[model samples]
Target chain A: MANDKVTLAHGAGGKVSQELMEQVILPAYGNPVLNTLHDGALVEMKGEVAFTTDSYVVQPLFFAGGNIGKLAVCGTVNDLSMTGAIPRYLSVGMIIEEGFPIKDLQTIVSTMKKMADEAGVVIATGDTKVVEKGKADGIFINTAGIGDKIPGTHISPENVKPGMKVILSGYIGDHAAAIMAGRHNINLPASVQTDCAPLNKMTKAMLEAVPDIAVMRDPTRGGVAAVLNEIAEASKCGILIDEDEIPIHAEVQGVCDMLGFDPLYLANEGKCVAFVPAESADKVLKAMRTSPYGQEARVIGEVTAEAPGTVGLRTGIGGIRVVDMPLGNIVPRIC
Target chain B: MANDKVTLAHGAGGKVSQELMEQVILPAYGNPVLNTLHDGALVEMKGEVAFTTDSYVVQPLFFAGGNIGKLAVCGTVNDLSMTGAIPRYLSVGMIIEEGFPIKDLQTIVSTMKKMADEAGVVIATGDTKVVEKGKADGIFINTAGIGDKIPGTHISPENVKPGMKVILSGYIGDHAAAIMAGRHNINLPASVQTDCAPLNKMTKAMLEAVPDIAVMRDPTRGGVAAVLNEIAEASKCGILIDEDEIPIHAEVQGVCDMLGFDPLYLANEGKCVAFVPAESADKVLKAMRTSPYGQEARVIGEVTAEAPGTVGLRTGIGGIRVVDMPLGNIVPRIC
Candidate 1:
């Protein structure tokens, strides 16, 4: 269990990490699904399955509003939900450095169990390994999942059309700014909290409301700008996003300005960008705003035919700016 | 995507690592199985499936006999083989450090695909992440897999009873000595190449010859000593082994003596410790000795109900010594 500190034997995959599992991780969430001791979990369920896996190697494992455990659960669950799958089962594999603190591990794992139960995804199977101190940071998590992929509901980037409107799910860049402040201990006028929560419910609601939604993407690592260019390229179309209509929280905007960062490039975990038909844009926004996660949703962009394979931004200076692909990493390990 | 020298952007899980996948890892072995992005690779057959996952994080990712890629494939396939599952599909998730060299990345990935083909397991899905330079040694791989669990075959530790003979499939400690020498530049009088190779064929042959093999374990980490003790505790039986009967290469023994290390505690990448009923021990040994991985198989010990939960070693001096469980780590990260 890589809690706070790390030792070398943890990565050895020997008795040290095995004991940590028997004593720490296993006992806290003991159930029949976990005791089978199989490699990847074997789950018997009653619906079409959607499986996804994500690896989390976040720096400063314990962050401001959430840790890697919470991120692991939410990240994979959201992937399932984006496809309108009812998130069902999850398998967690943790690699920790030896000599980590026991208390810190407890806090992170307890948080994970709570968050998973809230998301209606059961923790079915798990694996624990400890690496030598220098071999790892603090702790890293990789979660693979099995969910019921919705029947006959397929939404791909190729589905985007010329007059589709893009919806910004919530305030942008809050997760990125929160992490930066926590790591550097930066003082700010207002508290900055990470927008790290399970987005499955919000995603399912959106899918139910608008079954024809096209190109659903979580603006995570490279943020909205990176994904916008990717969606445009994939659909062979153009995206024209409004500058002022895009929503940003005050604290996040202040941090971006102070740090020479752009809200467009900063990461956001709990939010998503969805492209839908122009006629239903208002109705979709109304449905999104009713959900807890999409309270700040807005129609911020539209698909265009004039400039295919590119994304253009309407700037505050009354000029158009091409929102090209992110040149390099904007924020490291923000997820 | 563990390039020779890692860069910080790899850990970002964005563009840099994505390029690493497209250029280095994926192109080296692009196939239809890999194009399907699944969590654990799905192996379709006429019946049930077997699931497996293993993480590889070896220091100095490239080595003399083989690199971490070979180890990852061979190790996980061997695990599936031990469970009597015809090893089939594998998923590799690589966590690479920033500043790693591209040349080394190409070498490791090419070897990985080649070895996967030879072992008869397809690389179905893969993921790549880059960490900052200090976060990891070079690269760490997490592999998850699924295989078709064969019907009408039951193998477990509970089958071990009094009078079962222990069969060691090959020499001990060669891999351990080779790694220590190569990593630390120990100029001992030994060209001790590691005994690392795929063992699925050999295991398959042996299982066919002796269908009721009691227990089978790959003595990779913590070597023969750990497996011996684990079987003793699990089956509630004692193991009486003649130390002289155990096979060890001359070079490995020489290195073990100079370093004040017990050969029993050292790791071995290509070896197996099996328990079979006395009636089938000879048949199993003959079956194993016919294969590349188990050509030097030998009978080393016998199970006894007296002095349960303990392993007793018969010394060359005609004295008996009790072997205790290891307290400190011996050769951490030997995987």
Candidate 2:
């Protein structure tokens, strides 16, 4: 406990590692399965399941609203949520740099425990490895989640069709903007904090209300433009979005304007884009609006039969522009 | 294909990332679940499931007999196998350094595919991220595996009692020795190769033959000594092993002697130790010996009622040495 920093011994799978697990990790994320301390956890599972993996390497480990640990948990949970699965268990893998602050690691793990609890999942099993000081950044976390797939629910881009309406669950670009602001020390408005929260509950409600929702995608990484473009390519259709209808906070918008960045391509940790049949759009949107994370839900676009693999943005000034899939890297480690 | 080296753009979740997936990754690890290209994969899983995770940050990415990619797959698969589960699916998460060679990435992915196929598991889902050159080592892989837990399997340390016999799957120290030799350019014999192979099939056979195996653990990091000490502590029983009976390859022993390392404390990627009721020991050992991976399997020790929570080694000489859990970092990234 006196060791303020993580040493190579902490990850050597020896007494030091055992102490870390028993004193730090176990106490933070203790559960019956994990407490067993076997290399893996055996749990009774049934029905179809969704499986996903994601690694969080966001710079400035601590962002405005969440750290990499919280992002790691939410990202994987949201990935499973998108597949219409009731998120269940998560396995965490940490690659820590030698001499990294053990306190920071503990803080990150605490955040993971908090987020996992909020998402209604258990940290079933985990592995930790420490590399030499420069061999890795402070710490990178990989979380893989498993969830029981809901029967009668099929979520895929292939199910998207012409005349389907695209709904944005909430604001976009908040996560990327928050991370950027923290890295550059920009004094953005307090309201511009990262919108990093678990979207599974909101998503579950929407799915249950409208099982025919064609495609459900969380606009992380490449954001709305990339997601719409992927949908168009997969469904072999065109997507047209009214730029004005896309919800963007004034503060986040200001930050994007100042940085010459397109909010459409910015990453978001908590938002989702659902392509639902036109008839069910209102019902799904109403259900989304009922959730705290989806209070700003709105219909932003619709799928088209023309231009089979292109996304078009209809500007407020009556101009239409083709939005290609994001090219090159605008920002790295935004997630 | 023009870009022979990976760039930060490749992990930006944009057009370049898509090309990397479609042109390189997809072709190598394509499967029905993964081909859907959803954020996560949906699979039909039923019954008891075992889940585990491990991150491979082995230095000298490529060494004798295996590479980091192969280690990543085998490590997670073996972890699941140790729980008497038939490894079914694996999720891969890669953190790559910018400017890494695309050829090397392809090689690693291909190696993963080959290993997964050999292990009878599908690479169901994956994520890729690129960090700045100095922010990470060339590549670190985290693989999480899911397996169907055998119905009657109850492998645990607490199941160990006074009359259980410990069986080691094969020779130890080859994996750690291979990595060490590669790092220090030691002129070791060619046979000093990593014992990094998936042991799921062999384990499955053994479990089917002896349903009452007391415990199963892969002697990975910290090796046999660490594993034995842990078992002693967990079961609150004494473990007495015969040093002369322990399996050690001549070349591995020579290297360990030259390096002032204990083979008992060296890592092995593909080996496991199982505690079987004395009556079932022959049946389990026969089943293990029939598999290619377990040809060298041998009964090395037994549980004891005295000296609870301690591991005692009966040497070739008349003295008995108490083996404490490994305390310091021997080799940093032996895994």
* Candidate 2: residue B96 Cα off by (Å): 0.2
Top candidate on DockQ is 2
Give per-residue CA lDDT, model 1, range B1-335, as digits (tens): 33455566654545665566667767887887554332223223434444455666665566558888888888878777776667776666677777778887778888888878888888766666677877877777776654555566556667789999999998899888888877788775535777878788888888889888887888777678877877787789999999999888888888888887898888787788889989998899889988888888989989999989888998989898987665446776676
- Which candidate achieves the best TM-score against the true structure? 2
True contacts kept of each: 0.20, 0.90
DockQ result, candidate 1: 0.28
Which residue window of length 10 is worst by lDDT in model 2 chain B? Answer: B326-335
Kindly report which residue pairs in candidate 2 clash with one another. none
Quick one: RMSD of model 1?
Answer: 3.9
Error of 2 at A106 (Å): 1.5
**What is the C-alpha lDDT profile of model 1 across A1-335, one tens digit per residue?**
43344455544445664566676677766666665453334444444445456778876676667888888888877766765577877767677766667777777788788888889887776656667766777777777665665555566778899999999988898888888887778775445677777887877777777777875777877789888877888899999999998888888898888888989988787888999999878777877877788998988979999899999999888899998777566778776
Could you tell me how far off, in angstroms, the CA of residue B39 lies in candidate 1 after the best superposition? 9.7
User: Per-prediction TM-score, please?
Assistant: 0.86, 0.99
